[model samples]
Target: MTKLFIATTALATVLTGAAAAETIGVSIPAATHGWAGALNYHAERTIARLEEAHPDLDFVLATTPDSATQVSDLEDMMATRGIDALVVLPFESEPLTGPIKRIADSGTWVTVVDRGLAQEGIQNLYVAGDNASFGSTAGEYFAENLDEGAKVVVMRGIPSTVDNERVAGFEGAIEGSGIEVVAMDHGNWNRDTAFTLMQDWLSRFPEIDAVWAADDDMAVGALAAIEQAGRIDEMFVVGGAGMKEMVARIAEGDETVPVNVTYPPAMISTAIEMTVLGLTSGAPMTGDFIISSELITQENAEDFYFEDSPY
Candidate 1:
């Protein structure tokens, strides 16, 4: 009787262990830019946290620089590893939709983060930041801080739905505010490109009140150009994407960078958590999960500041 009881206990332990083990696959664009780098950092950190908390869960993180590469990575992950769940932040909407849809159809749980798929109906949960709100919030800040008739220059990102939404929201906010957008051009979301664009705008325009580099990476370059040209007092620059360096400036009450708009890269963690919740607890989750974009000002800078973060 004693031997039989011991055998039953061992079997139960093995069954519980098997039931607890779970696998998750994450695919994101490679860290070619500041925002992508931050996303990579947050993804790794979140995976570490989740793995520690759930010992039986295994997470696989894959990053690709382009749409084609990402598709290939996804295929390799699915074929070799047999992922139970997948969390993807695609490089482009159209190229990724069909491939991701096929993964979902294979009975694996799917979580789409950042960019959304064009075809839809595949994602179990979708998590993304409010790109429009990111721009609108910055516009509102500019409207309040600058004079009514202040002239500003705008530096944009790579042409995409995300960029379009931000530009639309920003323009909409400043429409009747008497703030004139003197120049608007694409910076390709790069520091050097933004620096060059700002230099040209400076040369063309005699008096500029402010500048907005929609992304922090470009903002850093814009600041460098302004400083190099000895035009620090000529304009105040505002950059979105709550990068660690910019957040620090806000914390220090830097007048030129008094406020920043947040488009957090940590949002991938939300997608991961939602995916896990659905798989483990049978939780119902679907549709878009839009994270809020809050303006990071001196008053609330501490809230958004992450000291150890690479971004």
Candidate 2:
């Protein structure tokens, strides 16, 4: 009779109480670029450690290729996973706002990472590297490092609020500078796309002094294009985000990559850590956590380089 009772209780626990487990859902973009790749690595590592540390905690980690699929992932998590909390890094802000807001309305704790939603106040907590600071810092580096009459080309990322802020901060800092922005185009934060754009620029323009590829992945692409065009000696590249490889190049004082801007992908780990704290501890996570972006030069780039880092 005792054995029967024990079996019955175990069955009930499996069938009905799993939803009662403390579940956290993580949604982020697929690793389409170097930054995104690092984000994925840190997120998975964090989730593994958290799950081991707290056996009762459950994690549902999802990656989306685009905004539309991300919406479906959110809905699926809500419908089937019984998530007590959600941590999202939006693929695109506007398309994600409504679905995320609906999740919040369902009483799920929401912590947004990196890119924000189109609508504000939808998330209970927001954690991201300061986009404005990233841009201005990169811009200021140009203003200080390059010549007054330098010819620089701009490579932009996808259309989003973060991108806009980065561009605005960069432009604001370079105001009245003798630096001429010869060409501007959206690289969509993709390496191949930036390669194509740079190739076109090389073919069209006889002289290109410098290029700001915005993101590290784009910078790599731009560099390849420059090498292929045999313009490596003519120009230098400035890329944001402290990718390990990029940081290493800067640490070695590579002339082509003299400096990089810090926009670490490990910010995803930060958001996950804070969200886990909010979930486990009595203190809830609220308001904004903006990470500062800084310059990575030869003298300081060694500090940013991690030998075994995935990115």
**How would you encode candidate 1's per-residue C-alpha lDDT over 22-53 as one tens digit per residue?**
66889999888778888888888898898778
Instruction: Estimate, for each residue in 1-311, the C-alpha lDDT of model 2 and write its tens digit.
Output: 22442354355458777444677889999987667888888888888898789766777888989999999999988987667899999888888999999999999999999887888899999999988999999899888877888889999999767789999989988877888899999998889999999999999889788899889889988999999998899998999888788888888889999988888888888998898898888685799999999899899887898676678
Candidates' lDDT values, in order?
0.86, 0.87
lDDT for 144 (candidate 1): 83
**Candidate 2 stretches greater than 4 Å from native:** 1-20
RMSD of each: 6.1, 5.0
> What's the C-alpha lDDT at position 201 in model 1?
83
Can you list the residue pairs that collide in candidate 1?
244-311
TM, every model:
0.91, 0.87
